[model samples]
Target: MSDEERFVYDGAHVVDPLGDLEEEGEKSAKHNRAKVGSARPSSLLYTYGPGAIMDLPQFTIMPTGLDEWDRIWRRRGPTPPRIHAPRLRDVVRMTLRSPDVQLCPYPWQPKKHSRSPEGNDLGVPSRVFPQWLRCTGCDMLGLLSQFDYRNTHPYRTDLAVFEHAKCTGRAGSGTRKATRRTAIPARYLLACPDGHLDEFPYDLWVHRGQPCAKAELPALKMADRLAGKGASAVIQCASCDMRRPMNEAQGEAGKAKLPQCRGRHPHLDAFEPKGCPNATRLMLVGASNLWFPATYSIIVMPDSPEEKASDLADRVRTALGDKLAKYRDNLDLVRDLLGMGHVDVTELPDHDLELLLQAASVSPDTPAEQEQKLRDWDPVDLLVPEWQHLVRPIVGNRAEEPKSGLTLATRELGPGLRPEITRVLAVERLRKVNALVGFTRIDDMDRVGDLPRRLAPLTRTSRPAWTVATEDRGEGIFLQLDENAVAAWEKRVLDTDVWHSHEEAHRRNFERRFSETAEQVNHKTRLKPPRYWLVHTFAHILIREFALTCGYSAASLSERLYAWPAEGREPSAGLLICTTASDSDGTLGGLVQLSEPSRLQPVVTNALRKAARCSSDPICAMRTPQDPEDFLHGAACHCCVMASETSCERANRFLDRRFLIDLPGSGLGFFRPHG
Candidate 1:
């Protein structure tokens, strides 16, 4: 996908401020900002949340932090709909310790169209990022204010861009024929591990932090010594005749030359009050590690699964009673009438229309207060409730408890199936909720356990009451590993050197980064069991196979793992492979159909057989976590195991193909090498 196209859902275009609002079906949109591009509300929580740099085709913008957004929302006539994700809300509230925490989609402008300009403000308020800009035609460097702004199209906002009105081919030193050229953000940026970001000090760097004759208005020229090579560039000042290679301001020398961190958060337009003590590190813009969001997600579950007789059947009957009058007797024909929009209850075996017809019409609806309490939890283990609902079907008095966002069925572990996998669940229809708590820059907060130390707040100092999130609809397949096999394998591997080596590698890798505050969080990376690596690796393997045979790229599908051991609970080893999208109200049945016994059996066997030996075998299969320099993963490489960074949890770390198959020939493979 094109860079701009990848962030938001497909078909969403840049909001043109000059367009006919009524003609396009939008009653109102921003007329002032003339935003050259637009992002969907879901994208706000993922790639472009508040305090993230949104590099669009026309402009490099940062979603203004919560500080400025609060004022704009105060006048709110028509605001974004508030989403209810009780499972996710419970976790986020527990994490942030703010009981009033709410989850909301990104706000939209007033939904009223009129001649008055009282409220024409468009999507989330944003500001131009990287105040500095460079003229491509001439090497002259200056702030963005010096460039001329232009919106080429009346309604196509993506065409709006910054341009150097006049260009002297000779670095602005000559008065020759001048032509307009698009301006780009200066290549370099400064940031620290603690999440402080600032523009490269171009003026101070060329002069070595000393003022030149033209210090007030320096004529800085950034000349390239080599194309696509940052260090080869040279920054020169025309006034003082001072020049320095860009390499001098990088690596070890950079710490001495670059100023101490100002604790600035450009997205918030404020410097942190705590005042960072560490030296800022030099970085190039568009680097992958620039922003990393720490999000909490959960599958939407029947709201009252945990309670004894949640009365959810009555609640769903009440909810459906109003809408069911027309299709009362002929539920079989409901699917044809709804045209794939509605999930018919008859599709699930346990909840057929006949059963619903035999029960009472509708009892008193469950109280909203009591209904919410079932979704609430003091304990923060988010996976238990979901596991119970997925493994054991939740049944009500007459018919199964129903949720509009979920339709599920189980293809139980029956005769003549693979011994390793004991249960398979076909989640024909599912909804997932995601919430953004905080983000980090420069380095990733790989495991959720590291969140406390690594998370960067949205604002400079203040804590916001609510978080931005999105609810997605899709389908998936859930598989549970055999408990006996998993327990026996853990026992067999517990004393082996291979398991100890992998465990030690995790400790060393995690300690290498946060030795100063290792005790802050639980240190999940240091304590992951062998079962985690086994299940996580299998997910990667199966998804890669799914990509080749099922026509879905591994990147498009994501995995939700359930491996942590909670007190007084049975051994947990289950993973869900799902494809979710906000635009697709619900997905086609292709993914769910693949979960059928006839199809999935061969796919599982094929994925394992292929992973038994990588094309890069010997070099790939023989490798272990010990040989690498503190890097995690064993007997796994890009060719065989590594998945897309977006899909794999832990950013593809802690994976070991050797556990799944005996590539090393030491009798460690759980599948018995060639079984």
Candidate 2:
């Protein structure tokens, strides 16, 4: 039910409150003639949320909805506004991943509501944070805090560069004054690993945090040198006659030279009263490490009929009369809203209502029992139930077949492969809902749960109760491997000195990246087991082969590894390689077609053959676990087993083609000549 407004842009021009324009003079004559309106699925806002600076045709903008709360609460009169939780159904179907987290909808002023004639009619508003802007004509610098503007309108369309009257730079003729062009956002910002973001300390940067009494206000200018490197770029302040190079704000030495973090959250229009001790690092606006979304997902599975009580409860609710049916799903909430005296349960038959209430309660077990149930669940436990649902003998509801979100088919494998290969399941359809729980800046995604609390809130005064999410429909191929064969091969690999050395190399690589001490590395880093390595490597090799015939780019395809190597438990080995898109129709059936026996046999053989030798062969095959350049991968490179990071789950690490195929001096391949 959440929605937001976004400016639409055609191939030729962009139209908005900011002066309409084409691609920098390509179609200038038709710029002002283009139409503008809000577009559906407004994915731009979802892709680039708060803290991201977007380059619009006229001006650079940073979308921020933090101050909208003050405007909204005032319109609600003297009483406090209520922030209702999203319906329970929405939690299960859409925002289930981050059940505890929620975000408020961006304020908007819609013209009309189709469902309710007299209800509130306001479209979602677009909020922006005016940070630093640079004038195009004079190339002079300015800060948003220096501007004086009115806030009566829902949108700010009057942003311009007029305060700097001293700027004498001209456009064409010396006699006429130059009209300054739209301002561009500053390219650099300061951030900490703990997700704190602030405008770059331009004044302190140029002066090295030294006191300046000569001038209260300084004029800053950006100068580009012939080298064009960031280090060569310089910022000069005219008031005190001081200039500093951009090089003093980058890399390890730059990080050390910078000031401590001030704990600024520009998106929320707030700052921590007490400063943070974490060292702030200078990062470009477009740096990849700025935002890393933390997400979790589970494969759809069937369960025992006893566990299917929710479905029965849904049927019972439908059978009940309209008055009772309305509140049947959320009886607790309705009961709280209307006192026991108002809710007349005596009207319903006592015995039937009791049974209905029992069925409505999804779990009769205690909290301890529920926790144990989830803890004992494994890959096999989840997958077997799904497999059972797929291989049912008969199709009951003919009308429901087309509407069902999932379509799956399974078959036994043919000869010419190792005995470890068990069954293959081709998933023709799948619906995956990925909810954005929270994001981290300049840090590995390990401690995502401990993110800053103010980042994802349902309201200004309350904690988050829901999160934004998107659903992706897709197709995939699943392969189940023989657990016994996997365990035996894993045992052989574990016994080898090479494998032991690789484990050490992995530990070293993690320590170097996260700056973790030796003792911390063991507990913090989740080391990939040998079985996981083999399955992950095989998935990558197959994905590479599938990309050629599946008519999908390798980057569009992603792999999901299902492996459990817990001691005293039966191990499970499976891989699901799928292509997903934000669109509703999912994808073409090329992947499912490739999963057929005739097509699959050759694909598997060709993939194994390709992995047997790399273009960088003898050198690649001979590479040791402790190679200076790559400590995580072995006998793998772009030319062979390595796949795009988007396609691989483990960031393209822990992969060794040697684990999947025969390599020189490596006789421990799981699928090598078994005779």
Candidate 3:
């Protein structure tokens, strides 16, 4: 016996811990009102009789915080009862309001190795737990803590022994005494709503050998006739003589090792039973508050293309029953459709109209679409202003920029020409000015022009009768001598200090002097020896210096030059020819023969026959007036500068000759030429 039970004295009835317990029992049937001082609402206050005076306070509407009593009442309404809140661990819940987060069906995995001798498909398929049944994170331990199970008990029953049993009721009269007892005095068993066998304890009377039926079973038992026949038999239990079904008797027997009922009273925690797949043995166990409904849905408004979308929506809703039709008058879906150009909103449909109305009653997507449709209604008059600003410049188009009174060509001819110039500039920046300079070299290798021609080389026979040679700083300079040169003239470099830096300034001075000299000589020579020879000579100097510095033999340099280009034209010049010459082995630097091979003759005779169109000035000659040459010579191309500086075969010699690696002031510095 428990310590609490031992406290009961032999003569005393049940003790009353609550002082009003007797009063409560006496007043249980009365619904009478309490005195006016009572805190609870009373029956008197709710009575509708004419003479029943309501002494309660008058109802008054007041601003929320403006009234002190209203504020206090509002604050008190949300406070929980004095009891503490339930903990997540201690909660034994049967129904959940929110949808449970789904976990991946296959969580744990097994390794791919053999374990048993009979290694035949020893792999186990993944076990899937019912979505509503199991706890997510932990192994089942966490789920057990949520329930309060203090009121449940277990019982022992012999199923085979009760297969053939019977019970007979016994009654007693005080004046008359029975000679023999029909059965033991019937004792009542406390019943559990959840079908648990262990909640109540009683005794049974047995006749033949068969299970007996209960005299006072609950409504479900009487109405449903539950319990299948001839499966497992339910006999009146000797301890708790309640008539249980065969399955119930067997389940109790299986758990017979649990604590047995010993005159202790137990109340079930709840009445509902759980049906979880994870449970090992199926038995009746009660769950608290376990009713739930099954399915749900949602609806949204369709997008609108025309203006009367709201009216149309209202009409549709009115035609259908308000409870059955969802009126989607909000504008959010329509706005989204407008932005996307078109949309099909019929794809998502909802059977429940009320749910659809709740979802899209105030949509933001449709309102914006309606606003835009109104704003862009007219499309014909959009571009009138732009055309007005552009008419004047189109009529006076010219080739070059004008200056001073000549109108200075407004920087660029017009807007249309600027784009082409920009495109050309962009190409130059990407490929470098060497793009123009390397034209002849590429042409020679790829056969770029219509006619193929060759230039004469200056051999022993081609040497003039009289040649003037001047030695300056270990470098030999050669010039053709003629009688017209009467003035003792000297070429001098001026403006040596006008550069960004001292070295750059000096380098510029050197190039300027060389280029100026070459230009002057070009003007003097002109058509006499041919323009091809001028380019060839300049190209030869660059190639020579480049090859010599890079450690190439003179013969190899000559061969490379000869293969590159023989004759080509540039934008400013015509049918240019070139030939190459070099000493065998490494003894002498290579040279390109620029003139025809003919025996030396008188200076005057040589000058006349080779006489280009010369003027009064001996330094001046008839330069081939411009030609419509579609291609450019390699020597004059700025692209060649970038190519030679970067990947040209003659880069070293060209750099040695002090040639600029890139075009200067050409606005194409970003480009690097590729070979």
TM-score of each: 0.80, 0.72, 0.13
Q: How would the candidate models be sorted by TM-score, starting from the highest?
A: 1, 2, 3
Put the candidates in lDDT order, highest first: 1, 2, 3
Count of steric clashes across candidates, in order = 3, 11, 34
Q: Which 10 successive residues of model 1 have the least lDDT summed?
A: 6-15
Per-residue alpha-carbon lDDT of candidate 3 for residues 240-285, written as tens digits (9 for 90 to 100): 2444443443354633422332221111111112211111222221
Candidate achieving the largest lDDT: 1
State each model's CA lDDT, in order.
0.70, 0.58, 0.20
Prediction 1 TM-score vs. true: 0.80
- Tell me the spans in candidate 1 whose CA falls farther than 4 Å from its real position: 1-32, 40-43, 71-80, 108-121, 171-175, 305-380, 394-404, 412-416, 447-453, 519-525, 566-568, 673-675
lDDT of 1: 0.70
State which candidate has the highest TM-score.
Answer: 1
After superposing candidate 3 on the true structure, give the runs of residues whose Cα lies further than 4 Å from its correct spot.
1-675
* Candidate 2 C-alpha error for residue 330, in Å: 14
